[model samples]
Target: MTSPAVPRQPLLDDAIIALHAPTQAWSGRDGDIGDAAIDGIYHGDIRHIRSVRIRVADSSIETISRSIIDAATVEFGSVLRGLDDDGADPKVRLIRHRALSAGVMTEHLGLHSHRDVPLSVAVTVEVAPEFAPMQDVKAGLAATEPWHAEAIAASDGTPGRIEVRSSDGHRSFVVEAAGAAATVADTIVLRWDIELDPRSVVEIGWSATLTDDTLVVAAAANSEIAVPSTDDPRLARWVEQATRDLAALRLVLPDHPEDAFYAAGAPWFFTLFGRDSLWAARLALATDPGIAASTLRVLARLQGTKTDPATAEQPGKILHELRSAPLSLPNEGVHLPPLYYGTVDATPLWVCLLADARDAGMPEAEVRELVPALRAALTWITDFGSGTGSGFLDYVDETGHGLANQGWKDSGDSIQWRDGRLAEGPIALCEVQAYAYEAAVRGAQLLDDLGEGGGDELREWAAVLRDRFRDAFWVTTPEGRYPAIALDAHGAAVDSLTSNIGHLIGTGILDANEERACADLLLGASMSSGFGIRTLSLGAAGFWPLSYHGGSVWAHDTAVAVHGMLRSGLLAEAREVAGQLVDAAEGFAYRMPELHSGDSHDAVPFPTPYPASCRPQAWSAAAAIVCAEAYAAAP
Candidate 1:
């Protein structure tokens, strides 16, 4: 006897096809099933179009092929059947071309009649605008609530034009149509009548423009950068995909229109993230130094000015995440203001980026101007970061609503001991200390070379911190001696062999012998899955292939480790890791996702994808660039 068969979910249902230009981005499902239920056109963190569907004579079209023409344009080929006058299967091909430019989207549709008889078809487009905040949309709460705006048909307008306005009259979207017999059937639908002769074609166009009551239009600027080429075909394709993904992720600030920085990722994290953007810009230094400069300036402008427990803001601290709307979860007692500053590592990472930008040959005057901000960041590291006077950087969420784990692995269960027990805060992460040390040493050099003083003070602090870290974090296990993941609240080493130690490479926090030991351990069978290094070793009690931070392989993390190995003169090890990353990229179509399962390479022919991983993530894209640059520079 056979059991009940479960319905197979459509892979394209959750697949993302996106196009963006500066502050404007449109993300949707691919193929003829482009449902706007969860997909929409977003302008500066606001959703404009919730649902858009095209039908011919009340018959839905089925997609045949789809392609991304460039960073800003997408083309889709679809066909409608059974629309003939004789009720026979029809051959009507529809070509849809969409492009985004300067906060406006233009869509062109081509309808061709392949049959011998003349065809008269009634085309209809249904659209709905939610005016929902991006955060609400990301949380999947927008569709359950009624739309915030009402669609108003434009009067005294040419042909087909409709406008939608919020109740407070603060935001509006204007949509215009051309080259077809069009009419506004109702508030949310438009009709176009097309007459095509035998073997004839007709084309129609539509444009949607978003406007605020303040009339603020973001200045348009291009973010395309040159990507390095390599002899390996797989590496070349990965670099090309990385370059395009980074270009599409660029977000221009409304106030500083001339400057551009990459948003974190698409779908959920398409906003300014302090740590994510800094790391991406740093990795892309070989490609474009301008990204590092612009990202540093933007983050400096938003640095914390005062202490506020409710939003986790503290003086001289960098922001963790920024949202366009206030986030409140009453049941969970969580309320995150738009500009929250709860990150423990971003402040130190900011100083490191400033120094990296200077090293990349930024103007001396510009680098000098940021010296004060760098000093303030260093001061935060000393005064606020080391709360226990232990000379180690640590963080604890003061507000019950803020994040529990404040490091890169911000999930609640991310920080744990070897016995699968959760560690107590204020937790000092192993990577955070390494980042702080690198920031200090590099920042001290910038201060001395840029005509600023007090380099010795930061150097002294870094020396002490490094000595303390080496003494407290290193542990001897039966298998081998490895660095602890972090220190718990009671000052006990939270000994778990994880990928966090991989970040210590190239940071100067590890000595030559220690670096070699880490490289060996990272490449060992318990830690490496042949695709990439796992977050946690397989022998650990908390190891699970699908766990977000425990056993998953993050593209960016692996890239960082490989770069460190290269810096440590472990060329063979670096190449081995890079080969696995390239193999994983092949499974992802050369567009790496945020992470994948840490399943053994021999267990499956292809890398297993994490269910909710964000594709085209900023740092993940930069990982490809980092690996390509490393290989090109290798002997």
Candidate 2:
């Protein structure tokens, strides 16, 4: 069999126009013409507008500078130059300001003339709507089918307003221009003519509104939650960026318009995710428990109700992810059904999030109402999660097309033995057991506090599981004793030293001595990249600094380890790791991506950006928040 191809970097430049608000977002390179390969406006997982190009006198303009003002605003400055009558340079500068909110994008363009003569310029904005699925767009594929567009006749006898309707009639948007001579030149082009005298400027305003009532209503009701500030400037900036990014990522579910939960990430995974949302919400609990509350409620409502192998759904199991459109990778034979429940950890993580939210001051009445869901989730852990009577939370892909490794490290090659061979079916990940143990203990406490019985049974189960995990998973390496990454189908320990053991800390699955050993290993050279903890150790057989999950340093993973260490009383180690994360965030302009290269910090002064890593990732953004909270609470 052919070896799997390594992931490739995006062809688009890093400098791009990206503005997002929950379910709607637009990302494209900073060019006069939008590249169909990587530029589009997406809504509900569908690409509504594929290409947007701005032309002046039939020539594409070159960008001089670009700046992102906030989550919703970006500004680009470009210049159009042509020889004057004297054959000298006559620079014509164009300033484009774009803002997004409520699924609407408004652009303001200003033309400035530098020469001492009047210049008449004909500017046109070309747009195309593909209505393509977001999955294909992210994969850098062109639209497979054509989407027809028809210009809407100007209403109120005004030519400044232009609207386009999709062929299917399910989607439509309007573009309006003001303070310039504007008209529809073609089915997909809007033209503006303006005359600017020497040293004078003429400005035009353009607005594109996606006619979605649900998005409009949600935007109006959404309010920003304030993140606490600290004396440390770096930490403060990290917190601010994380807070803004989280707010931008918040999407209002169609069923629950009043409440909001964060979509997974931008460019891809921008939808309700069972594990990612639960973890992001949990990390932000100290700032606002409402996020966790809403996320739990939404996931509870969507919990699996029956056995469906195609989508990997099982009764009482939390969903892995939900997408509005079915995704089929081109020629890859991998088709993702709308709903997936192959995750073994999300159910326990859901219970843990409930407990964390309650501790973070979620209202009692709301907590009480979720008791039934909590019980159902616990039942899932006891029944389906402990596959084959292994006394451990494990997972095996029921469908051949489903994810092979269903933990947070869901990539196919993520779970491997020390000798670099892939682990087989019914694999038991170490962190999944930690999550299960934590869920049981925390769930028992929540139940007892709420005057509900059955706490004793859960506590006993947790105790037994913890002891069994310690006996079965722990293995001594050359460096020290740490939990194996996972157990293979043959019940042999997959002895790859990885960041998975760090997750066991503070989860109550490991004893004090074991937690200390794990902490030491985390801070040691094998695991620590001086930027963040690598997913796998450097000495491991399959270690690849740039690999997606094999050795890349994930911000959220580092944050989790830091938080765990802090809770386990490893103050020095916690501070060191947290400080490294803050430094890495600075290297990424305070907007940390999903993961970065695991190159040694001494070898590379800055965190290496993982090609195609999601920026403003839900968990990555929340990592700063989690670290900030830990710093503030440190004694």
Candidate 3:
């Protein structure tokens, strides 16, 4: 019998990422691009440059050091032993500095010589471009056919330029280099022959500008979140590092340039995502409510206005994701339209963020402007959220090609029974119910504040949801009583002691005692990995440290629980989890990834990296701000 083919996915554990909104560059720690699967200069969902290398003829450069200066800048230092004068100290060095912007990537190469005599060398920059779509690259598919750039004659005083175009001419880019001769062969080459005087440095640079008309996101006008002052250096460093990453992730819709939201993450999800952007904005709300306000506006502009099964769009629904083209994963049986609306929680979360943003100092006028969208989203919550007649907010992928499980844990195996069985859909997740109840109550208060009237009805609706959730979602195991992860198709609780219960805290769906019960369960041995809360308890049959949502630790997930604990006045519990997040942040060098293994801290000195996790993920980076705020609220 033939074995089933293993899915091909790229590993990014060692890849260094630099990004500024729609443009990102992935390279090795030594700053060389194109050898690894994910190494490339990508602009607006297209890989513009596949490979980049710096070569010195007759001498080998040994990379000795690498430093990430900021979210969009990296520096590498290399020594040339063959060219160096014979001495204990190296006399010749090469420095490479790289930076990224909206659609441009710039690199400056500096060669320095400390020898008493002058040194002459030939330096060549080899570059190759392959116009591969983001999804194609992500799936580990073979690279699209390679394309060569055409040399554009240098005009007076300006740098020589070369233009690269895709076969379809839909995407293109230009390369410009000053004081260098350009040639096109097997690879595009920019050559410089220079002589460095004693104790002097010679520098040359080249820039690439990628152009794609189909892009929906652009670099924000300003991307700054005020870092909180803290006496604890660890908290300060985490916030500082996270602020830079969050700034680079900020993006604005081209049509709504004034409204800025965060792109989900790099190498894959570098575009507006409803759930991710909403949660990121919500998590960082204490530091900057303006971003939340703007993010609400961005998503509101794209709010669903009609029902479309193919894209999972329904009237007033929030979108799941936005991409330049349809994302199709044949192996996974997943196909998503550019503006799919498959999420179960983003709509309610949107309302929750809107109310929270207002409380966090968003301008009254701005909140007022979103009232219509708010009302429509509430309508969606009532009309379509429970369309499956599940008596709770639920999601089912009717297209069979969309996400099977539609909560934050969208993996197919995410909604599972405690005994390792995958739950059948239409799944009503416990956390979605909490988010919906909170949104209804908050939306009611906002409508009353705006004199729109409907506060009482909304409150009544929230009460019903809370009661129903209390009665139907709770389950008991040898581990004790807590809410189940979700309800399966037969109205039976899929009893999995998972992090979904963590989100129920402070949502008003659970009472004080219930919230405390959840806090205790989360801190217990099976669920608390000492690094952060695990998605699924270690004792669960389906638990695996590296499983995407089965038993992994997502920084954002822990932060959400921490935020809820703080809101519910569970200060001690909040601090405990927040500190664990701080430890995890330090483990990842203060730039958290999308998710990490749920390995016990006692077993591993540090949290293990989930090999394919995307670093600088928007929500994960924003988690730092939540942790800092939790620590700061130490009364």
Candidate 4:
């Protein structure tokens, strides 16, 4: 059997592959379509999709491919079969043709499952003359039955197979849509099972389908959520913008373990920051819990061990950020990140996550299994983490490429002296202690589930950490009082009263009064920037709204504050920060970026995206999960 010479495939039978109007919602939309946004990078080449259509028996299937990628040149079409895809009744269209522009990658775009018709799509491509693409990556290749047949390995009489590999050097997907044998320049076809499903989220998926020729091929599915009906034009536009942002946020997995995670955008942020990745995975959790689980596993596998010069990597340590690029180092030459580990707060936070997993009802055994890692993390604090040979956890990067202030805020002026002079390296930031305290407290819960000495050991660790932190970091002055942000290697206080000190409230390290005072400072006029709490007080000499960690408002950071407020029962204060942050996000398109500058509401004529920052950063994504809890708590 052979597939008929089909003439062109329409994206939708009658619908246009058009852009969202200026004022339109991306998701949860109403009947009306808004203005068109031309700036977007559709993965498929404009050359390929413009007036290109293939006739398929099923109307639900849609095929969009890109000539730019050497990986699977042929891609599957999503089937729009669910009630949500089409309106009340069916309106089909072999639709689409995107407006092209230069540097399209800068903006965001993705495949649209825009109809409710079912389809079985296949792709055919000619392999590079020299190499035979691997067919093993395809789903259900070489099988019988419509459900069973996806992609089958086939070779041209000349040479090679068809399989797609990612920029990170990892294979993506492969499938056979046609014949068992072929000649030079013969097409390698890959087919898909479903045309589209409204439930399709832009998550990883595999499917199979039968074609006209009984060809088997494996394929991957890419689906984006769209709002069906909406009243407000700006709201509609904002939703579409958000959906585009969601597509751009997809993380690029590397070919090998030692590679980096690169954001496919300007500032081209490419690193392996544990908190960031976990946070990003948190965003995708509702759509795919598997991603979150994989994130936990991957990060847990690399959990820090014994302080090394380059990273100061410690056992059971959750890394702050690991990179694989060459940057300006004090004396180092051009060296790629190759997994630079220079984070302090990642360790305790890792322990805290395990506790969260347990709280989220993860299995006791799964939680207990990571005890060795947790114990190692605790040991790290007493060992290499105490860079000053002091009991508290201090950070000193062995690598110049590594950050000096190794906690979340690794910027230079992030920590300061009481008089406002920036502190030097080998410092123990207060959040690490707070995170450690929280970890210990959470560890007690996890350990008690395991067996003997859990409660006693956890209690002992918490008590020591709590007492030492309270005494050592506490500060007092005639004007104001709060916990210190960090201590110099020599043990003098970097006495600047900043948000870092307030972070302690998040870890449950502060007493009731301390927590209340901390919450007050965050919401008080000195710190609250109307947009949200400034990273440091406005009165502080080192305060800089756009400063990386110095003053930028991180949604995740605020999320932590919200958690702290909730823990301390400061509902009003927490809601103040949480509500403002969410409302701020609503103004921006409902999509949160890595971080934003902390300026007064009127300071900027318009909100500015963080320069050289990663948009759709992982931690920023997870911040919403925590934020949702906070929003629901609002009363």
Top-lDDT structure, candidate number: 3
Which stretches of model 3 miss by more than 4 angstroms? 1-7, 146-148, 154-159
Please, what is the whole-model Cα lDDT of each candidate in the order they appear? 0.78, 0.78, 0.90, 0.49
| lDDT pick, better of 1 and 4 | 1
* Clash counts for the predictions, in order: 0, 0, 0, 67
Write model 3 residue lDDT over 231-318, tens digit each, in one string: 7788788899988999999999888889899889877888889999999999988777789998999899999999898988988899
lDDT of 2 by residue, 1-635 (tens): 99976433244326354546544444454544355355666665666777677778944577778877777777888877651345455467889887777668778888887778888888877766566666666655656344444344466665666566565566667767664454443336667777778888888767777753323214315648678778789989888888888888887677677778887877676678888988888877777678899889989988988888888787889998876556666534457787778789999999999988888888999999999999989888887787768888888877677777889998888998777888887899999999999999999999999999888999999999988887889887775678999988888889899998888898988878888889888888989998889999987889999998999999999988877887788777787888889889999888888899999998999988886787778899898877886677666
Error of 4 at 573 (Å): 1.6
**Cα deviation of 599 in candidate 3 (Å)?**
0.7
lDDT of 3 at 609: 97
Flag regions of model 2 displaced more than 4 Å: 1-17, 22-33, 58-60, 83-91, 160-162, 179-187, 211-220, 330-332
RMSD of 4: 14.0
Which pairs of residues collide in candidate 2? Answer: none
Mark the 10 consecutive residues where model 1 has the least summed lDDT.
Answer: 5-14
How many residue-pair clashes does candidate 3 contain?
A: 0
**How well is each residue in 1-635 modelled by candidate 4, as lDDT tens digits?**
99875322111111222221100011001111111111111221111111112223433333332221111111222333332333564333222222211111011112344444443333222221111111100111111111111233555542223343233332132322232232322222322233345423222121111011111111112324333234434334433444444333334233333222212222223334575555454433433343444446556667765556655565656765443323333322223254655677766766666666566566666666677876776666545567666778887766555666677776666787646688877888888888878877877776777873556776686788788877888777542788888888777777776777556775778878888887877887777666566777767777777787777777667767876776677777776786666655764555566677778766664445565344444455445554555555666
Candidate 1 C-alpha lDDT tens digits along 202-284: 89878788765442224337777898888899988889988888888887667987778878876566678889988888878
Q: Decide which is better by TM-score, 1 or 3.
A: 3
